[model samples]
Target chain A: MGLVGNVCVVGLGLIGGSVLRAAAGAGHSVWGTTASAADASAAAADGFDVGTDAAAALRRAAERDALVVLAVPLPSVGDVLRLVTEHAPGCRLTDVVSVKEPVAEAVRRFAPSARYVGGHPMAGTSASGWAAGSAGLFADAAWVVAAEDGGDPSVLREVTALALDCGAHVVPATAAEHDAAVARISHLPHVLAAVLAAVGADGGPLALALAAGSFGDGTRVAGSRVELVRAMCEGNRSALLDAVDDALGRLGAARGSLASTGSLGKTLEAGHAGRLALTEQRAAARTPLRIDLTAPDAMAALRALGSRGGRITALDGAVALAETT
Target chain B: MGLVGNVCVVGLGLIGGSVLRAAAGAGHSVWGTTASAADASAAAADGFDVGTDAAAALRRAAERDALVVLAVPLPSVGDVLRLVTEHAPGCRLTDVVSVKEPVAEAVRRFAPSARYVGGHPMAGTSASGWAAGSAGLFADAAWVVAAEDGGDPSVLREVTALALDCGAHVVPATAAEHDAAVARISHLPHVLAAVLAAVGADGGPLALALAAGSFGDGTRVAGSRVELVRAMCEGNRSALLDAVDDALGRLGAARGSLASTGSLGKTLEAGHAGRLALTEQRAAARTPLRIDLTAPDAMAALRALGSRGGRITALDGAVALAETT
Candidate 1:
């Protein structure tokens, strides 16, 4: 792939549509397709090059050696990968699916010949569809790019460049690690939100009326599309199960303490410390670092930086400019 | 008590400071005392009647036959009640403490002669101290007023009028019922947030870095002051324990489905339905009603309306103007 290749996005929903807009805004030749005729029409009406044919889009991407992004939801990943296999057998590929390991698995199973690099831009709104997307959706967001052992550096560079161009910093991790981390930070929260919402609602209208900021903020995401939430959560089932177990264990301990001792001191203190850590991390002074992409241990360095909460701010030729807090 | 009686607020923290501001804004005779010298000076500098002596404040409240508002935290309630007993025995009383049952119990044990009515305004920020408060804090908020059997109608009317004058709609409930409802809506969310925050932090810095809107919103209240959170959660131990058990049950079911069937469909769907219920309740059309405070069954009517989520929007002479959605 060239330093800045043409971009082809499959699915013109929120993430995909935003990718098309952002890539084009970054000066890449960009186009996308969607199964939803409404999304296609919306994108087309907005003067974007969006179509309703996945095969045709993949064929054109193959001809142009474009970086094909699977921006579809988890349920649609396999079918799109099949199309990629038939139309562009070994195209430079990446994705913006929420769960990383599952998408990576799908790509390996259906389009093994593709030079794939798994990615997930950690950004979205509760809204969906083409009309709900914008060029700035990913600005200043963390975009996770998988750093598998023995992975091709060239394809990784291609993915990193795309993410950086779309106005996001890169966070490198293995697909498994990405899945595990997100299960705690993303998927488990979704499940908990659902539970909290249901429980709050069960308190009848009085409880709902008494609900204030905490309830409103805690259950805000429960208002997201249910099927979409279920798809991402279930897609990362193993990792999410572990997170759920950890949460339940903590909750059980809290309940035991409250019942027997009338104190939630330990639980509240731990949570307070955790929140303080987050605040400190966000407010910490960042130190700049650069990794030469052509170096023998470039992938290792990238993964190490990401594991320590570092971000690749830009791709400077074969070097990745990064910062660590 | 006069129709617009004097309001004496002890413990000038966020809620107390706001009460002073709002009551004064509503043209009530207001005065407050705080243990924190900094808060006392700050409130005094703001041209409000603030002091540091609780006994002196209570003595003046006794002289004026004021409606005393104990806005102290749960752990301090007993100490403040002892002072109230010595200085203002049988004076009109209420409180803005988060937990209702504990405060009521304290009142019964320490100052049983005080004409007591329990209250809790369902409004707050994650901030504490006088500087963090404002007159508009309770605007359009639900201020719960306990409607116990054979409770004094005059005392309830004074509290109701104060809440309405402060720009809050009054929600009448039995103290025990209020505690149970808040456990589900207010206290459980705090525990869950703490658990969620701690779990996310356990994923290491990478997880925190990737924490987006969902994680942030879900754990927002975990950032609240740990001591304050502990006091309220521990204060309502029984009801919060039940709520915690309910949450754990739902979480266990979610985990089971994920482990065996790789689906969170039921949990997500229930959450969606719960969120929909909240939306519908907020959007439901309202019907106006009024209860004669002098009537024999006024307390029953008020409690019944409150149990159904009805709110007293205004006090018209001897009547409570309310609405049910």
Candidate 2:
């Protein structure tokens, strides 16, 4: 991966910290800016070249023609863009916001001199902060390299190279396309999970004790950070609302069929087929022979199985291994 | 574990097969009734005393004053109740149906002399059938033993004892309570997962590939056998509808709050709190110090960790050892 020089990363939160770490590990000099002095100290302790003055950091990086990554949340995108345009006049700009279309528009108006590519790495955990960041956080995950129609080609290339060097599969798309897709796949699911969980909570203590399997899995994202999810939903309000309406439409059909077995079964039948179609596209759907790692002494048994040859990904009640080519 | 002589298990599916195997391994004679000759032959091959004639098997068990477990699905419950009432008149009858109130009412109407206890063992996998059954399936799981007010105390005691012998924790509850709890926790989640999957499928192939983390998990139950889920939903219709409507009400509020930061953040804030409340109830909620097992060759690392002594559950990306007293 060829970079013009070093990189400038702002925000110093989980996403930005991870990007700084990954870039540094890839042998690219990274200058990080934190919103607070404590965050600056923590990042510096983590071996990052850090500062609290984002404008000064961007100016320094832009002098060397560095890529300035705005790894802040959606609410701060416009302010960050303004800072980048003022200090890093001709620098290549990229972002890690969940919603892309609004950022693209913001970039168009606020960062006129900067060549901008809106990007989002589709990987995260419930945990946040600089301490939670890892260099390998983006490994094997999708990084949407969302570009506008008239951006500098070299800037897009450099951003894509940076993402790939971080070990992400760069998905090329327009900002609108990325926004529409994430609204359906990411933002909508998070909000719905929260709703499902709130509903379960309303059922009282007995319902909580009995919650497992589908309930546990369905509401998994309800525990995500409120500020992050709220930003995602509010930023992409139209698309998120559209996705929710689509889901509620399907749910309404299922509800309508409640009184009739034939109709209810038909809804389930469609659902089953739809699930199969969607899941079959993913590589994880391949039925790896289950390694019975369910014993209480499961770790010992897994060792015995692994000695024979298998690649285990997730182990709960059982171990599932993807067959190596 | 004291039993009333031996046990008779009807229907040789995953649940029944597991029960039969477990009861037999615990030194009890288990006579099983299968719906088909192939099923009977398969059970016999597994060292079970199996037959295709349901009435004959029930009569034999009743004559010997045995505990007769009806481990069939919901649709077969009424027919099985008729058979037990006719042939196994005074037997202590219990069932493993997902719903309970209907069974309790059916027992009152159809099998007056047969002492009935409604039971549901809360354990399963994506797999089904006798081939997928294990003697330890019910181990460390909840087995709800629901008995009506007028049932003989001895019958409830025997049923609870059998659940214990099969390595389950017996949860004493009324049929209506069991049904309502299950509707919120189990049935409603399955239907909602299906709806979510169907909506994603409507988003087309791009959305499918982009679906990861919560999306994959939230829709995991969509792959469940359709008839089983349909039966679950239809059998507990009113309760399931109540749960769905409750979820919709929460979702509607979230929808209305899309424009305001205060309201949107409040929805997510409530969701975060709800998820914590629901998950904190489980013993698994305690954050045991994580033993990193992300290395492909992780078992060796686990063996070293195991030597330190604690309860080791399953190992995947990490070996989580809960601290012991």
Candidate 3:
């Protein structure tokens, strides 16, 4: 296959719909399936190849030897993986779900023979469903492709290619690392936003009225669909619990200092430094590198690159062109 | 006195500079002073009256019976209040500090004879200094005015007019109530943002690379000037401690639920509900009501309106025009 190939996306929600559109837009033959009648009809109305039957789509993917992208929520992962096992077992599989380890486990349980790679594009809006998706949604976004040791390098390359086709740079890490990182950056924020929102609400209308930019920005994600938020957070329960504990410890220390010395200077200063680190890292110049996917230690190289904040911007044949800040 | 009066603003930083510009724009004779020569020079170069000598400005205010608006940070409040006592003692006094109770207490300690009311505009940018200030900074923002019982109605009206002139709706609350409300909304968010930022940073550069809109928004205020953030949070120490305790309780509950039942549905649902309340309240139609500031229970009436999320939009003679959602 060239840099692109046939793409089959299961579950045409925001991420999946966008993946389908972006893949087709990148010159790959793409099609998708959705359980939602409205989403299926909407996708079809948009002149894209879409359907409501997962079994039929998986069968086509099986015959075509296409890369099947699972894009369902955590709760629905098992059901779709069952269909994949029934119709497209042993095919190249990847997913766009938020949590990685859980989905990988599900794939292991339901479709053990499949060549599976896990992925999560770190991009989304508060909106969901087919109509809310866009081909440009993943542009310049970080798409994590799990770099499991002993996994097929060809499948990994294919996953990286798909991510690049969707206009996202690929970050390669193990499923456990990806889950832990997202637990800190994503899931913990949801929980914090929820707690902050509830506390502000408990202060009654006056507190809400006095809320300004900080309050609005901090609690913005709490407005996300409750069920969706709960699913992802709960799916990564272990990692998220660790993150929550770390945050609580810091908060407790801050409280202790405040109650003792009337100073939150230490916590505020550390946070300031952390924010500065983020700003500087983002603004730092990138150094280019390449990893030969066919190399003996390619997976380890890719994992190390991701750990150091490097991203694979393009796949030149089997040579993964990467950059690190 | 007219609705607008002569205004003397101490500390020509973002808030004070903006207040000076706005008051002048509103046809009040406005002048300001700052300890920083840079801010004073910038304000002076803008062709409005400004000086480095706060004592001179306070003396002028004393001569003109001007309203002395103390706009210094919490740390510098005592020094400025001392100046007010020495030069503008017994003059109509108010402040634009972040915390109210501390400033109110400082007033009682340093300038007991001055007719004092505390104010805090719920508006600011991450940037600071005279150059960053704009006359429209507080437009449509909530400006909390401490409505202490036995606080002279005239001083309350003066502060309300200043807030209205600066294009902010006045939220009448007691100093304690204002501090408590802001602890929940402003100070608590700052703490949470700091904690969130630190946690993301702890996940290392990979996590920062994966940080998306949610993480960015949740920790935006963590990028603010460290000393300024520390000052405000530390100034509201007592109330912030309470708010922090409440947050810790909620977070602990979330962690427990996640560990025990592997579910965060209740927390997410409550957050969703809280966010919805904010949206609905902001969008709710307002019913206009007038509070006669000279009435026997006028202060009580104003506090009641504020507690119910009402605001005084304009001052017309002794009748304060207000609206409630």
Which of 1 and 3 is ahead in DockQ?
3
Candidate 2: which pairs clash?
A: none
All candidates' chain B TM-scores are 0.96, 0.84, 0.98
- Tell me the deviation in Å of residue B219 in model 2: 0.9
Give lDDT: candidate 3, residue A297.
99
* DockQ, structure candidate 2: 0.24
> Which digits, one per residue and each the tens of the lDDT, describe model 2 over residues B37-155?
87789889977799999999998988888899988887777788899888998888888878888877787788878878778888887777888788999887777766445555566
lDDT against the true structure, each candidate: 0.90, 0.73, 0.92
Model 3 clash count equals 0
Identify the runs in model 2 with alpha carbons over 4 angstroms from their true place.
A260-262, A284-325, B1-4, B259-262, B284-325
Clash pairs of candidate 3? Answer: none
Better of 1 and 3 by TM-score: 3
Q: For model 1, name the residue pairs that clash.
A: none
> What overall lDDT, based on C-alpha atoms, would model 3 receive against the true structure?
0.92
Better of 2 and 3 by TM-score: 3
Best by DockQ: 3
Off by over 4 Å in 1: A1-3
- The alpha-carbon interface RMSD of model 1 comes to 0.7
| Residues A193-293 of candidate 1: C-alpha lDDT, one tens digit per residue | 99999999989998888888888888889999998888888888889988999999999998888888888889999998888888888899999999998
